[model samples]
Structures are given as C-alpha cells and as structure tokens.
Target chain A: MTALKAIDKTTINIEKIRADFPILSRKVNGKPLIYFDNGATAQKPQQVIDRIDHYYSYENANIHRGVHTLSRDITIGYENARAAIQKHLNAANPCEIIFTKGTTDAINLVASSFSKRFISKGDEIIVSVMEHHSNILPWQQVCEEKEAVLKVIPINDAGELVLDEYNKLLNEKTKIIAIAHVSNTLGTINPIKEIISAAHARNIPVLVDGAQAVPHLKVDVQELDCDFYCFSGHKVFGPTGIGVLYGKEKWLNQIPPYQVGGGTIKTVSFEKTEYADIPLKFEAGTPDIAGTLGLATAIDYINEIGLDAITTYEHELLVYATEKLQKLQGVKILGTAKEKAGVLSFIVEGIHPFDIGTILDQMGIAVRTGHHCTQPLVAYYRVPGTVRVSFAFYNTFEEINVFIKGLEKAIIMLK
Target chain B: MTIEETEQEIIDEFELFDDWMQKYEHLIELGKSLPIIDTKYKTDDKLIKGCQAQVWLHSELKDGKVIYTADSDAIITKGMVALMVRVLSNHTPDEIINAKLDFIDKIGLKQHLSPTRSNGLVSMIKQMKMDALAYKVKRE
Candidate 1:
C-alpha cells in the first residue's frame, strides 16, 4: 500500500463533529447505527435541519417578483444562498450558479439545453464508463434525440480511466466531454483538471458530474476551468431536492432555457417573447425555497469545519479501512486506484454481497449494496453487486472497527 | 406427514438456535444438503426475478404429488428455497396450492429476509402453486 499523509488529530474534534449529526447516535435493529452510506446520501447536521425548520417556521414565502415584505425578505435569502454557493465554488459571478432539484436535474438541464444548441447529427459526446447512470443516461438521451454518437472512455482493471483511450476517443466530432469528478462506485477521483485541460485544448466544453466530489473536496470551477460543474445538496449533509449547477457565464449566455415558465421571461406578448438573463433564464417557477436555505446552511457548516480538515480526516479513514479490509482473508476490494476518496467496494469470497449486507444490517451497520447506480461498472467486475462502505468526516476509527467486526462475523456466517 | 406438521417440525428445528449466527449456520447446512436440480431445468424460463441472487425453480408432478427442485447462487437464498421445497414438495397438488407455509414467520425468518429477498420468496411460493394448479387442471 502507498503511504498516506497522516491527519493532525488536533485539526478536527471527532466527538464534537459526531455530535453535530444526531442520526449517528440512533440504533438500528438493536445495535448502534454505523452509517457508511455517505455516498448514497449524507446524514444532516443539526444546523442544516434547524435552518430548514426556521425557514418554514418564520421565513416561508414565495421568492422573486413579489411586492410584499415577506416575499422581499425570502427573495433576498434565496439569492443570498446562490451567492454562498457561488463563493463556495469560487465562480466569478453568483449568476453563474443555477439552482436545480438535484445533481440529476442539473445534468439533465445541461444535456437537454446544451445539446439542443451545440450538438448536431453525427456529433459525439465523451463520457467515462465509471459514471453513475445519471451522467450516462442524459448523454444517451441527447445522443438519441440529436442522432449523435456517445463515446465511452474505458477504465483500467484498477478502476482508473485509461487516459490514452480517452484521448483516442476525442476528435473534431467530439462536441462535449461529460464525466464524473469521482466514481461513486469505485471512488476513483478522476483527474478532472487534466480532463478539462485536454478537452479545452480540443475546444470541447467539459461538464463535470461533481455529485460525489463536492462532499469531500474543495471545488473551484475557475481553477479547473470546467465549462460546467454540478452537485447535489443531500450528498453534502443538506436537504434533498436542491442542487447547484455552476456554468461559465459565456456558456450560460449561449445555452437556451431548459424550462420556460413564470419567472424565466423578460417580456411576453403575442409577439416574440424575450427570456430572462443568465441564472433567472434557467430557474423557472417556484423553487425549493426551504431546501435552498438548508443547502446554504449545510455549506456554511462545511466551511466552519473546513474542507481541508474534512479531506484529511476522510482520507485517513479510507486508508485505515482499505488497509484493514485488505488484511482480512477472502476479501477482495474492487477499486485499487492510487488516488481515491471515501468509497470502499468489496466482495468476500464464497459469500454473496447481498447476504453480507443483510448480515451487516442485522448488526446495525448501514452499507450500500448492489450496482450503486453503475451497472456497467459492476458488470465489468463480473459480480452481481458489491458491498459498498462510504465514509464522511463525521465517521470515526472506532466505528470502522465495529464495521470490521460485523463484516468478519458476516463472512463466517455465509461461509 | 401433513404440511402443517412439517412446518411445525421446521419451526421447532429453528427454535434450537439462539443467535442469528447459529440460525444462519443451520440454514447453510440445509442449503448444502438440498437436492440439486438437473442442469437442463436451470434455464431462463425457470429463473425467478427481483432476487438479489439468481434463483432457478422447477417443479414436476409424479404419482399425484408435486415435487419441486430449485437452486440459488446465494447460500442463504438457496437455504430458504431448500426449506420451502422441503415443506411444500412431495405433497398433493391441492395441498401444495393451498398450504400457507406459515413456518417462515414462525421460524423468525420473515423479519430477517430483506425486502427484495422477501419478494423473491413470495415469487418462489407463487411459482410452486402455479405449477400445482397446472397439474391439478390436467388431472381434472
């Protein structure tokens, strides 16, 4: 195993962090809950929950274009949340941040609008095999609609993308390069910096599916120079049905509106109707006001804890888990990439992943099982599915030990 | 023995195990002891869907009794199927069709089965009854 940097224990108070998430203390099936399903969705902190509650309890009002005082206050709060996200992503302007339902929604918006404007028949879109179905299906749909071709970048046995293969697939016909910043199944953090630069050299815009990346890393859209970056709120300890799609202002101005309705228009007459500017042009009708507030608060929570500290703590935890799991007999981890995030996928010999997950659940350990929305990747591995354990900064070394004990017991039972 | 009597017997057998580990060990032993289905019977038509594990179930009528043969890729699923076959097979078509097989709940396995596995179990039972009904109609 390659040596990992040791995290400073003083940087993060694990106990205090755990206290922020109330669900961590709950019991499942008479055992203490050991949540290792952060990849699926993270447990919310008290601050985010309270933020949502406070929004509905006091500041509940429809945002934008209202003359009432409550509406003005809510509109300010909602727009402030957008600015917060813009700052978090380090985008040049707050208008570059377009709020959507979630990561899937954000991807669909880009796939539909951008493809309609830029892609023509026989045009090609590049994607990686390691993408979640959200990233794959949208491009597939656009390809089908536009009669364009979808090219997939293959992966190595270690779950890292074959950069040579990716370069070979890219050509003059390649209109856009859509890929995941991190594989939710393999936890391989793709070199998005390299990917974006390569695509940019070809003058092809790259859209990064940052659903799994935003939770664990500090994302700077300007630094990566990605055309678009999108992520969900729920995966980062916020409420569901809220996400951000950060697009370059030039690209945003070029792409047409995905959905048209109440708030997304400038002037509507029997004649030609003018659309609203940049961000408002994309956001239509009433949005998830409470969810947006909660997401902003979640971002604030992460900022307070600090992404550097969180990244350090989670990296150490992943290394500890990988080392311990590798030492166990009959256990085979799926992804062995040199660089990875919090996801750990493995299968025990002579034991099915479902059975192992079931046994683990009985012991109050929560781990995701099955294809994890990456069926092609699972099929490539030649397994029905895998047992996935994803960690967050809130998780402790002690919790990992409990998970190891449960997993060992499960293996014995199945064997 | 009657189907109810067989179910009660199986429930009593499960009662001997205290912990989930011991119960699962008994299940693994039962799976190991299950009669293997002929390779020809393991086709796609006999496959049960919605299971996390692939399960193939086949049934035949012999001397007015319905006999079931099944296999699963997962051991626990195989064991569960084996228990079903042990309880429901080698019985009259009418008995096989109508039998409640309440022993799954009595043995504390119902709560333990995952939602998908429970659905698979239901599909397994349904397929056996459908086979019995076919045989019963042919006789009539």
Candidate 2:
C-alpha cells in the first residue's frame, strides 16, 4: 500500500513482461501488443493454454457417465478442478462449489433458483449502484417475477460504497443483498465483510460478485462470511466458458437446478425422475471439461508464483499508473478510492474514450473503452464511457511508459 | 448514375478486385485509392460516436443519389472511410439504403478492425441509412 501511499509517478518497463505473453510479441498495425484490458478478460498464461491443449489431445472424454479409461480420467480431472476452486474460495465443502458458464450465468443461477424457492412478494433485493449489468439485470428479473422491490446503495464521488446508506437499505424485508466485491469501472474495493455482516443481522443472504476481485486479491469466503460468491475463470488467468459459484450446502440443496439435461439426474424414467444431489443438480449437461482443467492449472500456476507477491506487485503498478496518468494534461482520472484493485479509468479532455482506445491500439497498446457493461453507472457518472486500463501481475512499469507515450501522441493527434 | 447502372458498375468493379490487389500489392493500398473527404470535414459535430479513432462523416442526397463524405484522424480509419465512400457514393439513396456491402468481407476489412472499430463502422452505416430515410420522409 505504501507504493500508492506515496505519489511517485515515473516511467515503467513493459518489454520484460511482454516477453512472457506470446500474444504480446505480435504486431498490431506493425506495433507490438500492449494489452491493458485486463478488466474485460486477462490473457491466458502459457501453462493454462497448454493444459487445455493437453486435455483435448490426450484425455477428451465424457465425464461422470462412462466407465472407460478416458472417462474416469476426465472425471478425475474435472473433480480436481472443483477441489481446486474449493481451495481458492476456502469453501467448507467441495459440493458447495458449482460450475457455471461464466459470472453472468452464475449470478443468473442464484437469482432464478434461490428466488423461486425462497423469495416471496414484498421481499427486497439490495444492489449497489456500481454493479455491472450482469449482476443487476438477473436480480431485477427475479424481483419483477416475485413482485419484490429492488433497492440501490449509492456511491460517493470517489467511488467508494456509502456504508451508512447501505446500512439504511438493509431491513427485515431485505432477503438478498448482491454486490461486486470490486467495482469494475471505478476500481473501488467494497468492504464486503461489513456489508455481509449488515445483511446477515437481518437474516438476509448475501452474494459477492468476485469477477473483478478474485483475480487481484485473496478471497476467503469463510472470512467474508458471504452466503454466495461467483467469479469467472477467464477474468483470472484461466480459460473462458467456465466459472465458479460457491454457496452454502443448505442453500444449494434448497434451490432447484438452473438447467436440466443428462448429468443432473441420478435415475430417469418416463413415469418419474430423481435429480442428483447439490453441485451436480446445478451443473446440468456436459460441463466444459477442458476449461475446468485449464482453470485448475491456472490456479496451480498462480499458487506457484504466490498470491501475496502478485498483490504486492499489482499494487505497485496501480500506483505507478495513477500517478503518471494524472500528470498528463487534460486527463481526468475517474476513480480515487482509498482501496482499489489494478484499474485506471480516465478520459482526456476533447478526446472521446473510443478515440483514445483506437490511438492506443495503433501503437499496439490495447485498453477497453465505453461503459464496460456498466451503462447505468456510466450514466450515473454523467460520462458516455471511460478508457479503462487494467493491470495484471505480469505487466510492468515499462509497458506503462509505452502506453503513456502512445496516449500522448493520441492526445496530440486529437487536439 | 442511375441505381441500376450503379449496381452494374459495383458488380464490374468487384470483379476487378483480383487485379487491383495484385497490382496494389496490399489491401490497404486499394483502400487508399478510394476518394476521401478533406480535413475540414473532420469535426466534433461530424464525429462518429463509437469509433476508437476520430471519424467525421457527412452525407448528401444530390440528384436523388447518396453522396457520402468522410475523414478520420487515423490512417486505417481514413482508408475505411474512403472504401465506404467508394461503395456508397454515386448510388440512389434507396439503393444505397438497401445495399448490403458484401465487399467488406471480400476486402477483409473487419478482420483489421478492432471490436470498437467494427461497432463504429456499423454506427456510421446506420447513420447513412437514417439520413436516407429522413430524406425519403421529407420528399413524401
């Protein structure tokens, strides 16, 4: 935190880490790749890529259905992935972890399954003003169907959650409280533990959207005491089409399955059907076998590198980016949360976010532009969209320098 | 040109693409050959809303035909604008409005475009159609 505590904005060394990612070695319009769009999805590590390749080449088979050698091996690999995720979130049981298509699907699963079983008319669902559309829309559907009310917790100008306002929103009627552990657009890290506690006092179940937070920080579900947690594999250093939903066993058992197909049933007949228990009940059809294996591999890779080291390094990069970007003329940095992840959202005066993104692209530096799937939040900020540059642990200070130089050229070109 | 003549010309020109790319050596060179608007046209008022590059577009219904003039701060975008002008210009507003440019795939333009760039192209094309529609409404 001291790196951010002191305002020392200097140049960064991008080439060193650029060598690690093979994609970054390529040319975009005759320039090397400088991808800063980690918030959208982080690039996969070599190990994760190889693991997926290995699965297809060697162990491709249907899981939990067949008795062949490949099937048994595939099932083991799949379950190992679940166990790895259990460790990642520090869940009480492996069965508590359910595989989903991605964070969006995972949140939708909770909204539909849990709400249908437990929620009633006049119940309320609490969400923050900073949530991505994925988090907001699903709960909104549930609220509409059940005739329940949806409430929002307002954020300060600095993008930090208004905890006092959040406390006021919680009441006996509040049945579910869903929030992003880290704001994707603003980089604000919410006080999830306190938020969860506030909801728990009212006996409300809380769900933490960890899509942005899980990749940057260490998330302990037991420590946060959140009833549900969901994150996508692609947001981390893993493959796409895979995500994790961690819920308490009691709740998982109480809720029905989101999708139904082959794997979810224990025994099926035209007359009657018996559904498989807990995690299997939620999973449904054939899962993304290779994606889960790749995710597990990514976890191993992260563990090998060490989470503490990654966080420390990312903190240093975030500070470096913030200080340097602020010094640029006419640049307005969007979020200044006391606690943040590795995100820098800004807009240059007289330059649209799209223009900034394109100019950067020409220099082989990539950053995400527009509302970033948080249009309501963008509307709330009264800006069309922001050019968001997010950092991964592998990104270096030198890359930041190249990005700054590219941005300066872009600004000059536009002005 | 009449809408029928313009379609025939487009068909004739598209048939010459193999020779063009062969002679030009790069697809971008062919893109650059398309006529472009002047720098004066590139303004905030004319700027395309979703492009990563600064793009300005203006369209006119001259003699019942749509004539599009556009420019961009970036080279690739300028090239894209030029290409769009070549395909869209000298055609009846109705024809231009109805025509779906399959030539975009032939040129492999979208592959070179980033997702935002692709979106910008869609927005620009949408704007052109809107202008054509507005013109039709005014005439009626």
Candidate 3:
C-alpha cells in the first residue's frame, strides 16, 4: 500500500463550504447525503443558485438583437460572461470563447465544423481509448460521413493512456487528434500538454475534452496551446445548457458553423445571407441567457475562492478517501495513475457495481455506478463497471469516514 | 407546476412512503396503469438494452401526441414508469416537447434504479418523443 501523502495545504473550510449547498444538508434514507458523484454534475453553491434566481428575476431578456433597456442589460450580462470565461480559461482573447449547450455540444460543434472543411475521404482522426462517448462519437460521425479512418490510442493496465502507443498512432495522415484532458472513467489525468505538443509536431490539430479537468485544476488554454479546449459549466457549479469552447482564431475561422439559425446570420437576403464573426457565428439562436449570466457568476465565485485552494483541498479528500476505501476487504481500486484529480473508481469483489451503488444509496451515500459515458474504457478493463466516488473541494474527511463505514455495511450485507 | 400544487398533491396519496416493505406493491400498482404493450411484439428487437431491469417499450401517435406502451421485468422499474407516466401521460405534444424531465434529481428514484435502468427510462422517453416527432413530420 502506498502511504497516503499529506495533502498539499489548502485554505477553504470544508464544513463552511458544505453549508453553501442546500442539498448537502438534507438526509436521504434516514442518513445524511454523502454525495460522491462530482464526476456527473456537482452540487451548486448558494451563490450559483442565487445567481440563477437573480437572473430570472431581474435580468431576463433575449440578448444581442434588442435595443431596449432590459435587452441591453441582459446582453451585457451575457457578454460579460464570455469575458469572464475568457479570463477563467486564460485564453488569448475573449473572441476565442464561444458558448454552447455543454461539453457534448462544444465537441459536436468542432466535429461538425472542422470535419466539414478539413476531413476528406482518406484522412484519419486519432482518439484515445479512454475518451467519453461525447468525445468519441462526434469524430466518429465525421469519419463515417467523409470515409476517414478513426484510430484509437490504447491505455495501460493502470488505466493511464499509454503515451508510447499514442505516439505510435500519430503519423502523416492523421488530420486531427482528440482526447480527454482527464479520463472521467479512470480519473487518469493525461499528459495533455505533451500530447498537444506531439500532435502539433505532426501538424495535426488537437481538441481536448476538459469536462473533468477544468473543475479541478487551473487551465490556461494559451499555455497548453491545444487548438481546441472544451468544458461544461454545470460540472463547475454553473448552470446546465451553458458551456464554453475555446478555439484558436485561425481554426475557428476556417471551420463552418455547426448549426444555422436566426442569430448566426449577419445580412439576410433572399438569395444568400452572410454569417457573423467567430463567437456569434456559432451561437445560432436565442441562447440560454439566464444560464450564461449564472455561469458567469459561478466563474466569478470560483475565481474569488481561487483554483489553487480548490485543487489542494480536493487532493487531500482524494488521498483520504483512497487510503480508507483501499483498506477494506474485497475492494480493488481502479486507475492508479501517478497523477489524478480526486476520482476513486473501484469494484468490490463478488458484487456488481449496480448492487454496490444501490446499497450505498440506501445508506445515503450517492455514487455513480456504470460505464460513465466511457463504455469502451470500462470494457477495455474487462469489468462491467466500477462504483465511482469522485470528490469535489466541498467534500470532507468526516463524510469520507461515514462512507467507509457504510461501504463496510454494504459489503457485509451483500456477502 | 407551481409550488402550491406540488405541496398539495405530493402528500395526498397514502403516506409519502408508508412502509418500506410495501413499496414494491405501490410500484406494481403503478406498473398496472402503463398502456398495454402488444406481447406479439415482444422480442430482443424491442428490449431496452442498457437498463438493469428489463424494459420493453412501444409507441403510437394519437392525435398529434405520442402515446407510449411500456413494461418492465422489475417491479420497482414499473413504478418508475408509472411516475414518468404521471408526469408525462396526458400532456400535449407541445408540453412534452417543452419539458426536460430532470430524471436524476426529481422522483428521488435514481437511488432505486441502476444507471442502466436510468438509461432504459431515458430510452423510453426518447422513443416516445421520436414518435411525436414522426407525427409532426407526417402532419407537415
């Protein structure tokens, strides 16, 4: 057993932070809710909740088109969100950031646009074996449509991406290489900076699905130099239906719009209408206005609190959780990558992941159990699915203690 | 639905959850209300694959709205379908189109259903929506 290292120092108080989420205080099945499903949408803070409410109450109006006072206020709120995200991601320009529905929509936008322009009959797109379905499926659709080959980079036994294999897969014909910044299934934080650099050498554009990474770490899109970076707002305590896609200006200009609708056009004529610029060119219609406002508020909240503090706090929780969860009999931890972000995927011997999740739920311990949108990765490990306990900064060691005891009881009951 | 309506109707039924032992019985009763599924159509072709509980769903368009006939091998899952039907059954095509049906948070039921069962429920909802879409396209 690797000794659990003392966590990198953190400033935020977990109990104080936990109080901010109303749902965290509630009881489930007579026991307090021990939410461990941060991988699938996290519990929002009071600030985020209030921000959404405030938007609807005070600032509800369609943006971009209206000249009215309410419309201008709403439009400013929406664009301010874009600017906030531009800073949050540390992008080179605010114009580089375009809002979409979520991680899926962002990835699809790139696939639809870039593939329409660049992908041809015999080109290839390389994706890691550990990608979420959202990351894999869009590229797949493009390949199927254009008669391009879709190649996969396999993973090591520990569920980490085999960098050697990824290097081997890259070659002349690979037009695009897309991979997840962090494996949601295994919790393996890939060496994406290196991955991006390697693909760039081959002159292949890279898109990173940062749905898991952005929530846990500070991400600088320019520093990474990845051509495309995408993440969901909901995963980072923001509203659903709002997400950001950071694309290099050069690439975004070359790709066509993913959807054609009311807002995307510039000048409408009977014969042919011109399109708008980079950000507006992609956003098709009356967008999630309130959601964008709320998301911007969320970004502000996260920034004020600081990502360094959040990262250190979650790392401690992960170490504490991993050590305790590993100590129990019949427990086998998956994804022992040297670097990870607070996710503990494990399967109990002689118990199904579904059964484990159900039993834990009865004890008021919430966890995600199943393929987690990464069916290929779960299948690659030769298991049905593992019960995933992903921690956020708000979670505490006391909660982890209760979880360990509840897990013991569950295992005993199943036995 | 308004907060008042939710509060008023939420507790109108026999206790919110009376006895844990009798929970499955309530589920069975809920299952009984599901529109009739044609057994003749029972085959792997109609089976929802991702659910832990076996669910079989079939759909038909009735006067612009999609009517669904669904059944599940698991009793609890049948209750889940019943809950879905309560929220969804008589609603108009437009109403169905508008609702997102936050499956995880609402119903306090994902705890009862496996991820696969949840996925199956999702599939049933999607197929019903598709049936509506087909009806819309045909009308157009």
Per-model DockQ against the true two-chain complex: 0.57, 0.14, 0.06
List of clashing residue pairs for candidate 2: A12-A397, A12-A398, A13-A397, A13-A398, A14-A398, A14-A399, A354-B52
Over the stretch A47-126, how does candidate 3's per-residue lDDT look in tens digits?
Answer: 98998898888778889988999999888888898999999899988889999999999999999899888999999999
- Deviation in Å, model 1, residue A181 alpha carbon: 0.8
Which candidate leads in lDDT?
1
State candidate 1's TM-score: 0.94
Per-residue CA lDDT of model 2 for A145-186, tens digit only, reads 999999999998888889999999888888899999999998
Best by DockQ: 1
lDDT of 3 at A76: 86
Compared with the true structure, all predictions reach lDDT values of 0.91, 0.80, 0.80
| RMSD to truth, every model | 2.2, 6.4, 9.2
- After aligning candidate 3 to the native by TM-score, how far in Å is the CA of A362 from where it should be? 0.9
Those runs of model 2 whose alpha carbons end farther than 4 Å from true positions after fitting are A1-20, B1-91, B94-118, B126-140
Cα deviation in Å at residue A192, candidate 1?
A: 0.6
In the range B28-126, model 1's lDDT, one tens digit per residue, is 888788889999999999998643667899998899999899988777778888999999999999998889888898888886344655326667888
Descending-TM-score candidate ranking: 1, 2, 3
Local accuracy of candidate 3 as per-residue lDDT tens digits, B19-69: 542443454566656666689756787777554445676656666656666
Place model 1 in a CAPRI quality band.
medium
